[model samples]
Every structure is written in C-alpha cells, then in structure tokens.
Target: MDKKQFVDEVRSIAEGYFERGEFFCSEAVVKTINDVLDKPFDENVTKLASGFPVGIGKSGCVCGAISGGVMALGMVYGREHGQAMQEKMFPMSADLHDHIKGIYKSTCCRVMTRNFEFASPERKAHCIKITGEVAAYIAEKLYDEKVINK
Candidate 1:
C-alpha cells in the first residue's frame, strides 16, 4: 500500500474499533498504532490507554484521542531507564498537540464536545472521527519519519 492508503487504513481501523464499541477513543488509537507498527509493544499495551477515554476517566481534561496520539508517539520515541530521551520525542508530541488544537481550538474533551449531549449519537460520532484523525496523524508522522515503510 502507498503512504496515503496506509494512513487512511490506520484511521479506518481506529474508527472501526471505536464505532463497534470494542474500545474507546484512547484505547482504539493505541491499539491501532501498535498493530500498524507491527506490534512493537505487547498487545496488552492497550490497557495503558484505558484510563484516557472520555478525558481521563471522564473528567474531561484532554481529548482522549490526542492523549492516545501522544502515547502512541511515546511508544515510538520513548526511552527506557538509563537511556536519554529521544530528541524527537518532545517536539513530535508538541506537534501532535498543536495539530489537534489547531483543528479543534482546544484539546479539552468537554470543550470539543460541548455542542453535543453526552451519550448522544452526535457525541459518539465526533469522538470516533477524532479517534480516526489521531490515528491517521500518527501514521503519517511515522511514515514521514521512516519509522514505518509503505
């Protein structure tokens, strides 16, 4: 597949996971990125994203999708004990944050979904779209960085 196709596929997969109720926004992003990257981390790594859905257990702080994207970035750029942090880590994370904030005007879940009633179909759809966007963004960044080949 070409780069665009691969990114779109990543987005679709994440959206499907959320739409099917198999996972929430954060879980879907992490799970899809892990899968697309050929499972660099264990499948169970998705559990790490579970608390981020609905903005950190529904406190509505950051958007779960963006939070997931940051975690996905960490999966790629994060360091272990005694290792220096990857130079790209902080910049890439900030880039993802800016990208999402540029589109939504805020990264706060409550702010983004304020127009929709919680639990309504509209809200669900919005979240699913954001989840897919986040996944696609990560995929594109990875491809551009040559972290993943087409």
Candidate 2:
C-alpha cells in the first residue's frame, strides 16, 4: 500500500478499537502500533499503555493519545539493556507531542475536551478522533523514517 493508504488504515483500526470500547485512547494507539509492527512485542505489551488513558489514569494531565504515540515510537526507537539509545527517539517523541499539541493547542485531556461534558458521547467521539489522528501520525512518521515498509 502507499503511504497515505497505510496511514489511513492505521487510523481506522485505532479508531475502531476505541469506538467499539475494545480499548481506550492510549491502548488503541499502542495496540495498533504493535499490530502494524507484526507484534514485535507480546500482545500484553498493551498493558503498558493501560494507565495512560483518560490522561494518565484520569488525572486529566497530558493527552493519552500523545502518550500512547510516544510509547509506540519507543517500541521502534527505544534501547535495551547495554545497548546505545537510538538518536531519533527523543526527537521523534517530541515531534509527536508537538504535532498533537499544534492541533489542539494543549495536550491536556481536560483542555481538549473542555467544551464537552465528561462521560458524554461527544467526549468519547472526540477522543476516538484524536486516537485515530495520533495513530495515523505515528504511521506516517514511521513510514517516512523507513521504520515501516511501504
């Protein structure tokens, strides 16, 4: 598939996962990344992202989608014990943060959903959309970096 199609597919899968209540925002992003990478980590790797949803376990801090995107990036760019860190890790993660922040003006969950009532369908829809966007952005970045093959 071409780059745009690949990115859109990732976005759709992530959004479907969130919309179906199969996973929250963060989990959906992480799960989609893991799947796209052909399960580089075990399926349970998604648990690492579990607490990130609803803005770090509902503390209403950073956007969980961005947090998940960072974790997804780490799966590709992070280092292991006794291994040198990848130079792209920090820059790519920061780029994901900025990309989402640029769209919403803030990475805070509360701020992004400020106009919606908590637990409302509108808020859920908003989060689902954000989840898809983050997933798509991650796919595009990885594809551009040649981390993901076309």
Candidate 3:
C-alpha cells in the first residue's frame, strides 16, 4: 500500500476509542506492515504481544509502542548467531527505540502516567490512538526506506 493508504487504514482502526483492556493497534500495525511487505504476520511478534496492554498490569514497564516496535524488529531480524547477532542487533534496535522515543517525547501517557492505573479514560484512549499511529508510521518508514519490501 502507498503512504496515504496506509495512514488511512491506521486511522480507520484507531477511530474507535477504547477505555480499557488491550487495544489491537499493535496487531493492526503488524498486519499492515506484513501486508505491505507481502509477508505473513510473524507468529513470534503476535505471541510476544498477546498479553500486552494487560500484561503491563497497569505498570507501563516499556511503553506499548516501544514494545510493539521491538516485537516487529525481532521478527524482521531475530538472533540466530548467538552473541554476534545480539551485538549486531544493538544498532538496529536502537534505531527502532529512537523512532518510538521521538514520538513519545512529543505526546505521551507512558511517560506522564508513570503507573498505567493513573491513566484516565481519556488518557487511555489517547495512548491507544498514539500507539496505533506510531506503529503505522514506523512500519511505513521501514518500507519506504527499503528496510523491508512488498
């Protein structure tokens, strides 16, 4: 899909706000990116996120956005060569981390809330939408940068 098309698809998914429970925005991003790349949804990424939003237990250890980004990165370039692979992945992982961090710095509940339990219903909805947007933006950027292909 093209950039506008991808953004529109994400916007549609995020339009409906949710007050509680895990949002499927992360899954949506994975699905969209996979679609764009003509790749299947990586089972590992999906599994990693199965308990998210809820698994956070309202603590927000790693923001869902970053967590989801890590999942996608793992799927694209997971370790197989042990230590060497781990070392090689540092820069790549850092790139993904920085991308998410930039977005969070601008508008974030994960930073402000400290504890997810403190998030108001409005904050939850905002975070839900933001997570979706970040996922889409990163996925599209990777595709455009030729880091992945359709």
Candidate 4:
C-alpha cells in the first residue's frame, strides 16, 4: 500500500487493537508497526513491549507510545552487529519522541495521564489515539526516509 494508506491503516489498526482490548498501548503500537511494515518480526517483539506500558511497569517515566515508536524504528533500521546504524535510527526515534512530547509538555505517562484514571473513559480514548498516532508516525518516518517503499 502507499505511504498515506499505510499510515491510515496503522492508525486504525492500532486504535482498534487498544479499544478492543487486543493489546495495550505499547503492544498496540508495536503490533501496528509490525503489521504496517512488510517484514514480520518474531512474535515476541510485542511481548518485549508489554512492560513498557504506563511508563515502564506503570512508574510513569517516558511515554509508552514514544518507547513503542522507537522499538518500531529499531526493528526497521537497527543493526544486529553495530551501532553505526544508530546515527540514522536515533534521530528518527528522537524526532518521534519530540513530536509526542510536543503534544504534552512532558513525555511522562504519569503527567500526561494525571487528569484521568488508567481505566477511565477519557484516558482510554486518549491512550488509544496516541498509540495509533505513534504507530502511524513511525510508519510515515520510515517512508519519508525511504527505508520502505511507498
């Protein structure tokens, strides 16, 4: 599919996954990235992201959406043998981090969700939208950098 189409699809799928309880924010983000990208990763990648929710075991540090976006970028651009690839990968991940943080003054999950409870309706809707946004942004960045074909 085209980049636009892919981004849209990722957004929808990520949101659906979260809203349907198929996955949490972090899991949904990684799952959407895996689905949008042509290459399939080990199923455990999503599991690795499991603890990232609520800001790493709910400690509420960096946003899980940002973490998941970075993971998605790494899956696409990370090198198995060297750090050289990080020059490119890190910037992309940082860009995503910046974008997400710009939405709120802080990237801390606690700060971002301070207005709502974890299981509250508002928090649920907010998390689902952001999870989807991060997933879609990761896909768009990959396309913009020509890491993937349109």
Find the candidate with the highest TM-score and give its number: 1
Candidate 1 lDDT, 6-87, residue by residue in tens: 9999999999999999999999999999998899999999999999999899999999998999999999999999999999
lDDT of each: 0.95, 0.95, 0.54, 0.84
* Model 4 pairs whose backbones collide: none
For model 1 the local lDDT of residue 99 reads 90
How well does candidate 4 match the true structure in TM-score terms?
Answer: 0.91
Model 3 C-alpha lDDT per residue in residues 7-101, reported as the tens digit of each score: 66654543332223424535544544554455655445455564445225445455555555556666566665653464535666677666666
Q: lDDT of model 3 at residue 83?
A: 38
Task: Indicate the TM-score of model 3.
Answer: 0.63
TM-score of each: 0.98, 0.98, 0.63, 0.91
Which runs of model 1 end up more than 4 angstroms from their true locations?
none
Q: Kindly report which residue stretches of model 2 are placed more than 4 angstroms away from their true locations once superposed.
A: none
Candidate 1 backbone collisions, by pair? none
Summed backbone clashes in each candidate are 0, 0, 0, 0
Question: Per-candidate RMSD vs. true structure?
Answer: 0.6, 0.7, 4.4, 1.6
Candidate 4 Cα lDDT to native: 0.84
